[model samples]
Target: MTALRSRVAETARVYRLHPPRVSLGRVVATPGALDVVRDHGVDLPGLLRRHASGDWGDVCAADAQANDLAADPACPARLLSAYDTAGGRLWVLTEADRSATTVLLPSEY
Candidate 1:
């Protein structure tokens, strides 16, 4: 966890985006999400760096009007929905202030 957090901080520095407090979605602990993470060798920190640097794999939408970017019941604001190299759909949601980020599968959303 410490390593992951450090990587995220490094990423933020490189991208010049606000350093985000990162956490895995609750669903990530489920078997399904874990399987995908394992199978795809999901480099969370690397993915986050890519996302912050605007290397979005496939952007679904960006909503600046929403107040809460991480917990919106509906569409998440500043959403970066993309498929990983393994063809798994992943969603990265960042807070309006860019102070936090949550990574989850689309189904978890």
Candidate 2:
């Protein structure tokens, strides 16, 4: 457990050193997402931090590649990240224009 915690801490440090590639603009959460977070004690900010830092969480390879491309200022595409939580799955999306970021359950989307 200590080793696992150490690895997690090291990973977090790496992400912290890397700045967000795009602006989150306005952050909003759906009611369902809020309920899920509340029910499961989700760490919303930590998830968002990972998304912003390009961690991409549990996304598929193709989606991860798309997110990588989207990170490039010249090739802006929408950014999507999926994370599995105790409640279920949460998704975070940042628009291509960087106008907003939304947090929602897949059912809400």
Candidate 3:
């Protein structure tokens, strides 16, 4: 397997061991995110696993804490995580209603 795919599998395995903090509902990717995936080989599924598991990637402490609160299924706040990629920074965001989770470029936000 490619290194990225191997890492993504590992992440998926680990995440499977723990229940996700919140539901992703539906998952989608923005055009810019698809471009990053094609250009930089960013692991979208791995990042999504991390976000759902509450790893919160590269967010600041305050934002991380906010994400934690939003992680609760009862919280009507959005959840967001950031990760670095060869192309640039990528963001994973789940809406407040947990109806959808989107992989996107920070610029697209």
Candidate with best lDDT:
2
Q: Which stretches in model 2 have alpha-carbon errors above 4 Å?
A: 1-11
The predicted structure with the larger TM-score, 2 or 3, is: 2
Q: Write model 1 residue lDDT over 47-101, tens digit each, in one string.
A: 7656554545455345322222433435434445353545376766665444556
Instruction: Please report how far candidate 1 places residue 6 from its true position, in Å.
Output: 27
Q: Model 2 over residues 1-109: C-alpha lDDT tens digits?
A: 5774565466678778888767888999999999999998887887788898899988999999999999898999899999877788999999999989999988887
lDDT of 1: 0.53
Kindly give the stretch of ten consecutive residues in candidate 1 with the minimal lDDT sum: 20-29
Q: What TM-score, over all chains together, does every model reach?
A: 0.49, 0.87, 0.81
**Pairs of colliding residues, candidate 3:** none
What lDDT tens digits, residue by residue, belong to model 3 across residues 1-109?
Answer: 9785566577668777876787888999999899999888776776787888887777999999999888876666999999876688899999999999999999898
Q: Per-prediction count of colliding residue pairs?
A: 0, 0, 0
Pairs of residues at least 3 apart in sequence or in different chains that clash in candidate 2 = none
**TM-score of candidate 1 on Cα atoms, chains taken together:** 0.49
Model 3: residues with Cα > 4 Å off, grouped in runs: 1-17
